[model samples]
Target: MKLYIKYMVSLRCKMLVKEELTKLGLGYASLNLGMVETMGEITHEKRVQLKNNLLKSGLELLDDKKSILIEKIKNVVVEMIHHTDEIPKINYSGYLSEKLGYDYTYLSNTFSEVKGITIQHYIIKHKIERVKELLLYDELNLTEIAYKLHYSSSAHLSNQFKKVTGLTPSYFKKLKEKRTQNLENL
Candidate 1:
């Protein structure tokens, strides 16, 4: 059985899911961001227990097929933006379509319908969040950050960052104070 989860966005989240599965005496074949694949089918009671446990930790086990697909799309975008070392050169629509094996239009429409926001908007929001992280670490300059995030140029990155954050990258970096938001909030 496979389970899709919301707010399972980090390595720590994967670990938590694995731990919970172990506690439930369930063996999982794999636990990736936003999902878990088990070796055997789970009963309704187990599913209910798992859902309640996950909810306690600020995660939700997705049951609807459409919701699962939407979570998959979100996971892909989150992983590509926050976990990968390099960004791809291809357009996001094409890349996502190829990755998910669905038409870009269908994916976009479904994502928007379920998420109440465009996928592109979600990507932009995540990119801005990443930029904030990079700036906080003070590891890269604007130009380097732009390149790392696959922006056309530093100006483009700055513009989007400002638009979403209400502060330019330089100003944000200068603040030098942490202002982290929960992934679920984003």
Candidate 2:
């Protein structure tokens, strides 16, 4: 049996889900972002228990079709952006459609209706967050970060970063450095 979870976007969330599954004595074959495949079918009582346990950690077990579909879309996007080593070169809507086996229009409309943000905007916001994370890591230069995130150029990445964050990427990195120095001094 496959279970879908909501608000499960990070590795921490995945670990929590795994812990809950083990605690509940449910054998899971595998876990993915916002999803798990159980070794066998889960009893309704255990399902309810798992749902309640997950809720304590701010994760929701999704039984509703619309909620499950939205979670699937979010999981796919999050996996592509934050977890993958290299993002695919194709356009995201087409990629989402292919991955989910749904019409792009349908997915877009559902996401906007539920999230109050267009899917493209959602993608942009997540990309910017990932950029922030990479900047904080101090490992990749801006040009390489742009390339890794599939931006056409560093200039394009800077433009979007500034547009979304109201700060340039260099300034953002500088802010991180200044804050780290302050923390070290303290």
Number of the top-ranking candidate, with TM-score as the measure = 2
Name the lDDT value of residue 115 in candidate 1: 85
Worst window of 10 by summed lDDT in candidate 1? 176-185
Which pairs of residues have clashing backbones in candidate 1? none
lDDT of 1 at 136: 84
Tens-digit lDDT track of model 2 for 1-186: 999999999889999999999999999999989999999999999999999999998999998899999999999999999899978778999999999999999999999999899999999999999999999998999999999999999999999999999999999999999998999998
TM-score of each: 0.92, 0.95
How do the residues 67-130 of candidate 1 rate in per-residue lDDT, one tens digit apiece?
9889899999999999998777899999999988999999999999988999999999999999
Regions of model 1 farther than 4 Å from truth? 177-186
Q: Note the clash tally of each candidate.
A: 0, 0
lDDT of each: 0.91, 0.94
User: Residue 78 error for model 2, in Å?
Assistant: 0.6
